[model samples]
Target chain A: MARIEINQSLCKGCALCTLLCPEELIKIGNQINENGYFYAVFTENGSCKGCALCAKICPDVAIEVWK
Target chain B: MSEKKIFSRPKTLKDAPFHFCPGCHHGIAHRMVAEAIDKYSLREKTIGVASVGCSVFLYDYFDVDVIEAPHGRAAAVATGVKRARKDKIVFSYQGDGDLASIGIAETVHTANRGENITIIFINNTVYGMTGGQLAPTTLLGQKTTTSPYGRDFMQDGYPIRMTEILATLEGTAFAARVAFTTPKNINMAKKAIEKAFQFQKEEMGFTFVEILSACPTNWGLNSIDSMKRVEEEMIPYFPLGIFKERKAADVL
Candidate 1:
């Protein structure tokens, strides 16, 4: 199993990670962060392959993945 | 279960959050630069010159010494820093407006002199910090605050291709243009940055890497659409590749 963490405060809700994730586990959530951006959240943690594509494509570096 | 950290932030980058808009490529570029610095263990020896623009507060992000230069004067300031301390690694982070328009002379002259410094040029097409205005590298027919009806080739002349222009100078050691639209492109851009920094470490002549970045806020596009704009529109005008690479024998 892999683990993914996103710093909510730093996430800008760009959703680039959501679009790039091969597993489609990341998504823009309705809940807003302190910065007011909707922010990205994992939909199915078990489905994450830990490819780190989301972290790699994230311009904000808000996502971290561990395998 | 013992958890080994598989991914984490680069030590060279501070823990503070970036002030750049969401989806802005500056953060990615900063990460790549910091990674390179960490890989080469140059955190203490590197001195970055930040030009006037959105990245003016670059000093706060990088753990190394960073000096703020007047708008478009980063190359000149970096040149002076390198000369004063030849043992130290020097780099300048500049935007399109800072390098191509205001600091064109300094950038060109510094490269012509073969100064051992690296330049990371971020070309987001428009002036991102001071509002979206037509920049020197703004694509023809692209609209901005200043060019309300789109950038007219007749009035705007044409988008300035600084990488191509700099490659012609004999003093330049390496010059390339790269984009950051997809995962593959981001990896390529990181390699290009690494090569540029490596060239400087080897005491090679001036090196430059022009990164075609995204400005979603100013471009009036969503983050995803802005990335599409870079690949679809910007790449056609600003082709990505190493325009010049001086071999060991070619170096003076």
Candidate 2:
């Protein structure tokens, strides 16, 4: 129902988005991106309520959500 | 006849739906800027230029005619805007990277020239818009992306206290550093910003506010922790108050 996208190279792995997401839709994965920064990945695509909380808490401007 | 209280947020800030996490001061800063716009009634006529750091979307956050500029170039662009239209209240919103780091040349030169504009400088110590990297204002021993262990004076150099740096420049009409650590501090910051705007509105000269903001994500702490760090660690490095005030003289 909702779509979430993260600029992998830009994601700073802050976990702020992961912590702020009430739906528990975002998380930091073990994989490293081109920038060597650990990126936060959308885990529960089904739970994301298109709230834009990830986009708000993201310090690096990494996440975006659309429904 | 009673005036109704407008118990509502600005139309530009969207709903209670914030993208920022717990304890983030960006929400508070956005509200303050909005409240200033409301107090001054400059939302329609004033134009704002957003810096390319943590508050890069300041234009999105502030209720005003907005324009985007490259990192650290907001002052230069705002300079051009103010010069072209003296009637409009032009302001630049920038973060530490955009102001103190990459844009230092622009910032200094703009203030030195006495551009009739107000600058809101949000200094959170690190390069927040990118990563938890060392910035010009990062504390001496703070850890950041570039300084994995801690900032070393011998190698990392000294943290820049920008208000003090700008105060000595004759072109600076007013410069101050204020914090948003608590409600009292927030009110002080608002008052300082108001005076800075009043300075420009009176065609006084360049005015700048170095606001000690919170960067929880970059600091590797929760939002409350970030605010605490600012009060405890960062404040010692970057002291608060009005470093310079030519407006006080001009009033005489």
Number of the top candidate by DockQ? Answer: 1
Residue lDDT tens for model 2, B129-201: 6777899888887899999989999997998889998888878888999987654676688788888887887
Kindly report the docking quality category of candidate 1.
medium
Candidate 1 overall lDDT versus native: 0.91
| lDDT tens digits, residue span A1-67, model 1 | 7878999988999988888888888889999988889988887657777788788777777878777
TM-score of 1: 0.97
Give the share of true interchain contacts found in each model.
Answer: 0.64, 0.00
Residues B23-113 of candidate 1 have per-residue lDDT tens digits of 8989989999999999899999999999999989899999999999999999999999999999999999999999999999999999999
Report the TM-score measured on chain A for model 2. Answer: 0.87
